[model samples]
Target: MFSEKDFIAGQFNTIETASFEWSAPSNIALVKYWGKKENQIPANPSISFTLNNCKTITKLEVAKKSDVSSFSFDLLFEGKPKEDFKPKIQKFFERIEKYCPFLKEYHFKIDTQNTFPHSSGIASSASGMAALAMNIMSLEKALNPAMTEEYFFAKASFLARLGSGSACRSIKGQVVVWGKHAEIDNSSDLFGVEFSDIHPSFKNFQDTILLVDKGEKQVSSTVGHDLMHNHPYSERRFAQAHENLSQMKGVLSKGNVDEFIKIVESEALTLHAMMMTSMPYFILMKPNTLEIINRLWKFRTETHIPVCFTLDAGANVHVLYPENVKEKVLQFIQDELVDYCQKGHYICDQIGDGAKQLN
Candidate 1:
């Protein structure tokens, strides 16, 4: 088990200036994590497929400074100064300061950009925080040259989780598991771990994001997660997540696409159901969201295409299917589902191998 003491850095090598850049992909949870505890600890275990095209690229420029009292940083998004983003970054720095102690010793300039539209329900936090965490870890590695590759990634994931719970899964590979489960090896609530024993049939799975609504959600994820605290069915939902994860593990290993579809779709609906049944009873899904889902169901039923849909705390629909049926499913989407999207816009993505440092 890793503790706060383990991640604290020792004496660092002297450095005048350093710059690092990274791109991290967003992920879609197969077993959704709805609630949280203190310090971003998840109420239930979750698994996700790291996405390819939808990502955030972040560049960090760090210079040593004499004043170590507080963190100093300038922030930019897509080449424009974004004052509203500073508070979130400031909070993230505060949360991770103990783990990465060198934060206060440097003045940072962060320039970030996202491949997909921000606040459009694509989980910019996951990719953005993961990219920023990777850049921070790069500086840490520069200070401590002896750090191993495994430790670097594990600690990066740990730091990312401090920023956003789902961000931890964006740090590594085609499949990642966050939060501890009895069956998964090396799984921990502290950081996400890669799941590498997946069957070939699940490899390169396609994910087409249908933009049901392109505007910001009415309720933020933090508020939605908090509602679970007083939710009547929170306990049952957490338990169901565990059982579904176990079943998913078997389905992934055995290459059962049919069972995979069932579990994935059920988990997505259960996530929203929790929101609808909460105290405030808010719904994130739009009319087009349901239309797209129903059309997907009809298409899948008639064609037996094995395609499925999942939601990510928003009105957008993630249409998932195997590589084998890409042509048919994509055709069905273009012919039927594109009209439901905002401005006929959608992104075609696939399972990816997590984040990577840029040259």
Candidate 2:
């Protein structure tokens, strides 16, 4: 918690310049934790490792003002101003107000940049929401240092979900959890778990991003989940998801790459299965998507090299392979997947560091 003397309320005037920045990596979930209970919370607990190359860097500043208690941000896409994203900025302001009511009294200017493309299915939402939440909370801490850092992150993540579902996972460490399970009140106590005990296996992993396409999805995750609920197979899908969750935890806990590979591949397929079995029978996977999956399997079978694949609610496929085997996977992707893959679809890597303060 920050201290009162340090928490200069209107001290926005005394401090000429106050700034903070953080570079947070994107995360990939081994056990696809989906479905929300309270305000887009997940049904079961899930774990993920933050990726290395893929990340979002954010910086914020506060200045004393007289005219308007306003907020603005320079949103960019591929290095160009993205004024169309103003609504998202507005939503950030609205959400922060709910947490730190005092924010309504100050004028703020936020600047954010995404190393990854916007809405390209690379967890851009995760990075963006994390940066915003952390930056604003930094401001609160500066004013009144009494706030606990963990509590601040948790509250920020809890609110960030209003902006995006996956943002909750961004609040924690190298590994994180999403859903009500992460919430303290949950009886299950199966919240987000960071793998702190073991020596990190993914620290050196590098991600070579493969940006298949930036086109929006035909059906949003929100709509897709609704369809799943109404689908007659929904109940069965939920049961299978529960089972997969348990298996994924075991595979990761043991650090058995072989078992981990099996669990990830199965979980990816199962997620698609749930999607396919939806009442209306919508298919999120494109022909190219299937080709990528097939290539991964063939590469594994032929070369005895192992790589993992995970997909969210879109066509983009995240390929996970070790640094040692990267050349093999890269060559294989170039030969088999390049033609079908989008011009810019190649991000590769493993787990990454958690969120923290930056100068």
After TM-score superposition, the amount by which residue 116's alpha carbon in candidate 2 deviates from its true location, in angstroms, is 2.3
- Estimate, for each residue in 133-238, the C-alpha lDDT of model 1 and write its tens digit: 9999999999999998988999999999999999999998899999999999988888999988788889999999998888888999999999999999999999
Could you tell me the TM-score of candidate 1? Answer: 0.98
lDDT of 1 at 14: 75
| Per-candidate count of clashing residue pairs (backbone under 3 Å) | 0, 21
Models 1 onward score TM values of: 0.98, 0.83
* Deviation from native of the Cα of residue 276 in model 2, angstroms: 1.9
Best by lDDT: 1
Scored by lDDT, model 2 comes in at 0.64
**Candidate 2 lDDT, 25-111, residue by residue in tens:** 667776676555644656555666666557777777666555445653455544566778778778766754545555645555666
Task: Report clash pairs, candidate 1.
Answer: none
